[model samples]
Target chain A: MAEAREPAIRTRGLNLWYGDFQALFDVDLDIARGRVTSLIGPSGCGKSTFLRSVNRIIERLDYVRTSGSIEVMGQDVLASDVALTQLRREVGMVFQRPNPLPISVRRNVLFAHRLHNPHGQSRAEEDELVERVLREVLLWDQVKDRLDSLATGLSLEEQQKLCIARLLPVKPSVLLMDEPCSALDPEATSAVEELIWELRGDYSILIVTHNMAQARRASDECIFMLLGKVVEHAPTGDMFVTPTHSETADYIEGRYG
Target chain B: MASPGGDRSGPDHLGREWWWDKIAQVLLFGGGISAIVFIIAIFVFIAQQGLGYALVDLDLATYFTSPEWRPTSEPEPVFGALALIVGTASVTGLAMLVSVPFSIGAAIFIGEFATGRTREILKVLVELLAAIPSVVWGFIGLMVMSPLLMDVFDVSVGVSVLNAGLILGLMAAPIMTTIAEDALKAVPDGFREAAEAMGATRWQVIRQVVLPSAKNGLVAAVLLGVGRGFGETMAVLMASGHSINMPTSPLDQVRALTATIAAELGETARGSDHYRVLFSIGILLFLVTFIINLLADMFVRGKKTAR
Candidate 1:
């Protein structure tokens, strides 16, 4: 399986602290290429922290410190020499809520593209790019008639989809989603889950979720975490059916979070 | 159905409490309503006195068109307001030109870039600037800025439209900065995060996301600044040389509407045409500031609803 291939993201001895409070232990992980890897745990288990660390977004907070090496596409992202903008261009991230710029839908989709490609694009090229990305995220048919409308005016589901669509134009290799569907209803969650599933084979995705059923249903590989430590990382079916550790077993069986 | 303790109090107690509540409500409402009433009364009084002269005693065409503004001449007192209008416009326009960019930049720096102790210090300094009185600003203009202008521009008299504009701009900047900073702070952090995650630099995020989100508030800030510059009297009167002529250039001496009214209102005879003309200038000034403030309110409201 392609899941057995080289890792898209590899981290070693990833320890992180916020101020004096350590949030991540000596963690090690190898998320496979072209696979949807779900990081699931109870609240405050540092699942989101782990996901954010992959893209180095946690460092945005002044007090955050990490002693780790995170390699994306075989390049060390933790190195001081690496340009942040360049690293981020190769790795896109979506937040807990859908946050498209308060601009028109078309501009929200084209913002990152224009930023990365400052030489500029022709009108036809921009139109095609917008449509292509929107269609990939299953939003083109719904919002095609009102591309100039403000993105914030859309329903929550469409806004989430648009947020995802905006990332595609940058052509990042890996997409990190931090509870991307947390703000949506159940039906909208499933819709976004399907979109994420569809995107799996083309892009390596790391999704953090507290929903066990969502992790089981949507991911190819699942990593269980507890107290900033990884308990088990296995194929989704195997992890659910026959967990190696008692913690994982208890968690899946709904014995305890 | 007797209560544990309330049975001891009769309906009269409830009635007394309700009566006191009504009195409190009336007092609060009256205080709020009186402000509006006073505003309307002032407008009515100014309009009645001013319109009587403008419509009856004055030649409307010469009042509006002629640059000559000699009101105390022997046979026929001329009350041309064209020069005063130009003076007000020039001074306010120059003030906006000087203040807008600096205020916006300062606001962006304070709101978006600075952090921790630096942010706190800058904020306190800005508030201190706002607390300084207009009369003190006028004093500063008279003593410090006027001499600087005289030395730098080599003008005969230091006080000119440019000098007044520079002083008024300084006076208006604190308000502009404070409001603009609030608007910038109001932009969601999620926008910055999203832009950054999409490989945008800090500058790119600010320009494309933060600024566009805060556009309405920024425009409102500029409008408020313009209102401040328009209505300011003492500083302009003290620093503008109070010349009653068309301001040919920024360096030329000028007299604004506010300055004219302040300088002449106390000296004019109570029932004379000159007194009514001063009131007419007051009406014009009031209307200009009123329109600017109205526009600012609309933009501020637009920002709120857009969110």
Candidate 2:
């Protein structure tokens, strides 16, 4: 039924190496457009590496080698001259640590735009963009007046929201979140999960999460991996209630991570 | 005699405790008095010898303002302290100008970035620099750096303020680097990681996050270095040329107060006005060093409070 829809990102025979140690084996996966896909796996599994490869973030690490192709919007990102900065702007990320800039909240949001868009938007336009993104993240009310305050001074949850706001100003086609709620409290976690759910209509998102419940609650499609290889991929409801793979079933059932 | 075993030691024990307490008290008092006596004796000696000329003959402002060092023929013998003051101030100032950036930069490089064997090598280098005697450094400045600089600048005479400044700056660099690097390293890694994750380049992270967070430590490093520079006498004396005149140019020969005291005290006849003038220079040196250390302490305290 979902075959008609375009796949926003596609990975084929993807393998990754950190020097002699291979972190990821050959893997093939398709992430559909306008959906939240959560990569769920045990620790040291290639789920995060796979997600990073989708946007070429792992390539930034020294001596990291990857085989096969990650095609973003049907263009082979690995093969082409697509600049990492340009790709990063199109495929923005929110890290596990709420990595807010040391600068003010306003500048944090504006920084991506400044680097990616050299034409330089007007001050009014940038301010409006910051406000709009902050509102989308449900952070505008808390940060609307004190946009100039240092981003680090915010509470952990607000800092995460500020990070999301920062990513949105770049207008990414797909957003990658690497365990974004890992540093947040339950209330903050719910807020972020809700934000992701609300944002599903506008952008394709691939979230790497260990929280099984979060994957069930927020993702439309789920991919389960064990030891750096994708074990199963299916619709979230079926993947959770009746997993196709025994390892995935065991993982989802809390038998083993 | 039947019950004496438990009770006969009372008087001796009490006396022993009392005697020990008395000895401890005497030692503490003696130590305190020794420090005070030494300090007071130096001040009193300086005052006893130099006070008459400073108060009666020479005006207070003139002593600080008059640049002429010669006391040849005036009835009052025109003994102004301006040459000494300017000489000391200029040497210290030049030392700071050379030391500040080099030390801070070296410190950041060693503390923040270097690793394993490379870091160990740098550490050893710093330790070796520190272990070298100040007097030896002074001699080196006199024999090597002073002449080299004069030749490089193509001046007739060597051993000027410039030579002193360069040597002092080089000597102070390792000390500053070690202190500053330790301070920078003490800053948590979280700050740098956060900055980098925000797409800040390495230099930007260093300038904005790392430096600002380590501001207090950097200031303290500079303070420690400045104190070391101020107290460095032998090096300044040997390389500063001991020319009683003000430093008119980088090549011009000049004398620091430390150099003047070292050079003139030998030639002057005992109890002469010139002998007393050398003593006055010592007093001035003491006062200037005291003021600088006090300022540095104040700076460190102010920074701590700000943080």
Q: Against the hidden true structure, what lDDT does model 1 obtain?
A: 0.91
After the best TM-score superposition of candidate 1, give how far the Cα of residue B12 lies from its true spot, in angstroms: 8.3
Output candidate 1 Cα RMSD. Answer: 2.1
What CAPRI-style quality would you assign to candidate 1? high
lDDT of each residue in A1-257, candidate 1, tens digit only? 35456799999999999999989998899999988999988888889998888888787788899998899999999999988888888898988999988999999999888988999999999999999999999999999998999999999999999988998998989999999889999999999999999999889999998788999999999999999999999999999999999999988888888
Q: Can you tell me the CAPRI class of model 2? A: incorrect
The TM-scores, one per candidate, come to 0.95, 0.78
Chain A TM-scores for all candidates read 0.97, 0.97
Clashes of 2: 0
Model 2 chain A poorest 10 in a row by lDDT: A53-62
In the order shown, the candidates' DockQ scores are 0.81, 0.16
